[model samples]
Target: MKAFLLLLGCLLATPVLAGPRVELVTSHGTLQLELNEQAAPLTVANFLRYVDDGSYNNSLFHRLIPGFVVQGGGYDSGYSALPSYAPIENESDNGLSNRTGTIAMARTQDPHSATRQFYINLADNLSLDGGRSPGYTVFGRVTAGQDVLTRMARVPTGMNMQLRARDVPDEPITLLEARRLSEQAGGTMTSEPVSKP
Candidate 1:
């Protein structure tokens, strides 16, 4: 009886591990993302910081390349650049790949320059995997609403005078809100609004 009781206590003490999930409410539609904290802990934490602080709310999908990627989480509805936290270390060596439906960080020429911007792969981009140099860090995958992303990809894009960039959606695709999912309830956790600087 004591052995069985001890086993029960051990089982109860062991914590359940669940990958963090975020629900992105966008003008196109809602997307569910499951992050691999085990593979890319730094990247996942960076993304969750924005989600938890509501910094992603009302952001626009500023870039879209039909056959390549759908990028965002940087500019606001007014086309103004949002403030970002300090850059994070590159975790591209994480086993994750830039496969279709996988979300990865967007960075400058410098490998560790990734901050607030991210992109979702529209196709399998094996060339992005780490080899000669560090690659893009893919921290999560879209668990739902891939069709919405397809729709966003199909939207007409052109050079925006404000952004001075091409591939800007003719009609803005806004991320209405982004919130973390509760591990036990399968419901969203409310985030405090982050004031733009």
Candidate 2:
């Protein structure tokens, strides 16, 4: 009985392995994102670099389209596009959809032009799913802080000369800090082996 209890305690202490976890500390609230490496490996790895390097700190959510998505991870409070590394290949065919709360890479019309910018879907954006169109890669999802995203969607927006773009938030919502959530939870944020489609 003593041996069994010891083994059971050891098993309970073991941590379950999981995908990478990221925490976004925005002015509105903090959001937890779990990147899906199995579905979007390259994109996940690229985004994690920005998180690890503290590039996302002080960044602002530059674009917010009603009933569409809240886009960020690139611009500062001044609405200037931040420098980024080389773009990664589109992995939208990885069976993930641009569903509500799902996070997707933001790119130009060029399918392979996603670098640092990303967006969170506010609705089921089937238009972003792959089929006839070159779909945006869905890499992660908002696991917490949906209220923060919802508040973001309702903020007043307009064209900004700084961004030279429409749908810009009149009052900037800043991402105060970003870090790997695992660091606080005693887990390491490591990229996993991606199974190809």
Candidate 3:
């Protein structure tokens, strides 16, 4: 009885901690990103909210630049902007750099305008870091399927008929699903789209 009671006490006193890892089930391939909640708490929370809400399913990676960034998390496969939550505060001051494979929040000219859009840095983008003003928030980095992101970057891009936007992938790179690692089907997070026009 004493040993059992001691074990219970130890269990009660042990802290429970969990970090977030989101699987990006995409057309080009799968990508897994590990968020830095301690460094960018608000940003991480906002991102997880969208992940938890299924807001990102079937979203398009609307912007693609081979050596720059691949942006998404705002549009559906039809190229329409998904309804976004109210903007959140910029966590750019978190000291994370916009380096290769890092993921950052997308915002307008206002530093605190991040809502539901994000981008993956394909190269060291020092210019996007905190300068005279708060830069884009770096909340996470691609932990797996970096090559999948690279493949997405190489996709042909031009003016998109749906968005009438330039630099849009001629062939849409769709995010088919997003989920926590523990909840995802076991497979390579990176695989070419089963089918794409």
Candidate 4:
């Protein structure tokens, strides 16, 4: 009976595995992201909601700054707004930094207003970490396709009249699909057809 209790206790003490990986097939190339649910559960869950519901398919990477971030997951290729769930809590204090290759939520001045929009850091943006304010939540990192993100960073950007936003990619970088890969298939590159700008 003591051995049984010990085994049960050991089983309960085991840590849960990290969240599933998501593959973002974009016009530039594919990027595989490994989410860190253990650190930022709410943020990870919020992102997976969009991925699982196919809401992120056919989306546009509207904002691209050369050495900052590539923001998207809110607008479609036609610049139409995509529906979003309720805002999630600020998980910036989860000890994740806004480092290069890290994927973080994009919010407005309101610290807890992050919904569907997200961005990938092109540089180590440590200033974005929570200090005086609730910083952007870094819930995942790019496990594959760093080169793809590099190519995306070099794309020309300018003011987009349709979005009325600056730093818009001159050539639309559409997220053709966003799907979750099985645990065994995570970080493995698959030969899938990618769309072009």
lDDT of each: 0.91, 0.87, 0.86, 0.90
Ranking by lDDT: 1, 4, 2, 3
Q: How much does candidate 2 score in TM-score?
A: 0.84
The stretch of ten residues in a row with the least summed lDDT in candidate 2 is: 188-197
lDDT of 4 by residue, 84-172 (tens): 89999999999999999999999999999999999999999999999877899999999889999999998999999989999999999
What RMSD, rounded to one decimal, does every model reach?
A: 4.4, 6.8, 7.5, 6.0
lDDT of 1 at 99: 98
Candidate 3 is scored at a TM of: 0.82
Q: Flag regions of model 3 displaced more than 4 Å.
A: 1-18, 183-197
The total of clashing pairs for model 4 equals 0
Residues 25-79 of candidate 3 have per-residue lDDT tens digits of 8997888888899999999989888887888889988999889999999998777
In Å, residue 100's CA in model 2 sits off its true spot by 0.4
- Sum up the clashes in candidate 1: 0
User: What does candidate 1's lDDT look like per residue over 1-197, in tens digits?
Assistant: 99999999999999777588888899989998889999999999999988877889899989999989999999999999999999999999999999999999999989999999999999999888787899999999999899998899999999999999999999999999988776545554543344333
Q: How do the predictions measure up, each by TM-score?
A: 0.85, 0.84, 0.82, 0.85
* Candidate 2 lDDT, 1-197, residue by residue in tens: 99999999999999865678888889889888989998899999999888877788899888889899998989877777788989999999999999999999999999999999999999999988889767999998988899998888889999998668899889898988877764444454433322222
